[model samples]
Target: MLTNGLVVDLQQKNMKIALIGYGKMGRAIEDIATKVGHQVVLTIDDPDFDAETLKKADVAIEFTTPQSAVSNIKKCADAGIPIVVGTTAWYNDYNDACDYVLSKNSGLFTATNFSIGVNLFWRITEMAAKLINDYDEYDAFIDEVHHTQKLDAPSGTAITTAEKVLANFGRKNNWVHHENGIGSSTNELELSVRSFREENVPGTHTVSFKSDIDTIEITHTAHSRKGFASGALRAAEFMTGKSGIYTMKDLLNE
Candidate 1:
């Protein structure tokens, strides 16, 4: 429903999207998709999920659990339907799913955190890590909090931040979940990441670099899930004809 004068007169491709999980994320994506003129052709929530119905969709948006994400991707790949997965905790099989999609000549884009703001925050964290790499004066740590219903600890955002810090800074090569109240010693640079579960909190991540003189911190907090929903809808628009593994960074680049 873009109505601006500068908007590109792109032809409206008839896209039939199949929603794999009809949970909160699914419902939000449905709303955003409809607002932007796409159709939700099918919705599958039962264990006895019908692949035939999913085959009718041009694309599938999956937000299921760790146990079912790979299977769902495999079914859709077999049906020749491109997919975008937002589910986490099943990433051990992520490259396997990418291989399956490539083998079938299909498209797959997966993201740990789908919010545009979160993606930008990731970029900023990388830049900060590079800046701190040359100076041994700062030590970094990450903390993330999500809703109590979230299944994974050290939410995906925290892990991404930790990885960025490790990649740009040589001080830390791995991350350990700091549960309870224990922290790493002063001599060792530790990227302490902690997760908190509370009711109704969408998501919040904080990355801090500390030193004796001053401390620098960066944080991004989601007021609601609407931002992620909008980003997924935009991603669907971007993945129409492309085939390969993609991320929110690719969407931003486009």
Candidate 2:
């Protein structure tokens, strides 16, 4: 299938897709899936969908809220179907979800942000974070912006970026969502992520490191939702015959 202009190979002869959320991203995935010769057998946005309906597809793609994500995923697993989850704010049960998939011997793929450019941007952020590790004077912070309708603050993308920074930069231990405040204290390891909500913004993320003399920043501003949708389609295709848990990093590395 063609994903964000890149071609990907699916192990199956053809794919039958089941979308668990029929919102903007789900609609975008449906458009791209049809264009690439896949069939969307089911599109569920409500609670009436059953396990039989879910089993009709080769893979299921979920894009719901945290409150609904795990239940939808477990249902797909119960149906013995592979699933791709794009929802955020539900990492607290990620391990349990993995165990469920493993028990069923079913496939599960997930990502915080499925845009190809954003995944590449993550690599760049990691590189910059490593460079800043040597120079402790350069402190790092994150800023994210999304549409008003988006539920979570600081964004799942921003949180992932912050985790990437903390992994590479030794001085940082935790990230604080400074909702409306930004200040550096003398003793605390304060790394803040600020979030903004505007109208019609697809998404935006900035990772910045500042010192006394200069500052460095890397930013990724999504022009539309199609990139995320395209990546999800690609992930679904990749998961057609796979088992166990996988991630966007694994897909990219493959």
**What does candidate 2's lDDT look like per residue over 31-117, in tens digits?**
878866889999999966788888788899999888898888889989999999999999999999999889988889999999888
Q: Lowest summed lDDT over 10 consecutive residues: which window, candidate 1?
A: 1-10
TM-score of each: 0.89, 0.92
Candidate 1 structure quality by residue, lDDT tens digits, 17-136: 898988889998887677657899998886578666777887888888888999998888888888888888888898899999999888898888888778889889999989987888
Model 2 misplaced regions, further than 4 Å: 1-13, 180-188
Instruction: Give per-model CA RMSD.
Output: 3.5, 2.4
**For each predicted model, how many residue pairs clash, with residues at least 3 apart or on different chains?**
0, 0
Model 2 worst lDDT window (10 residues): 3-12
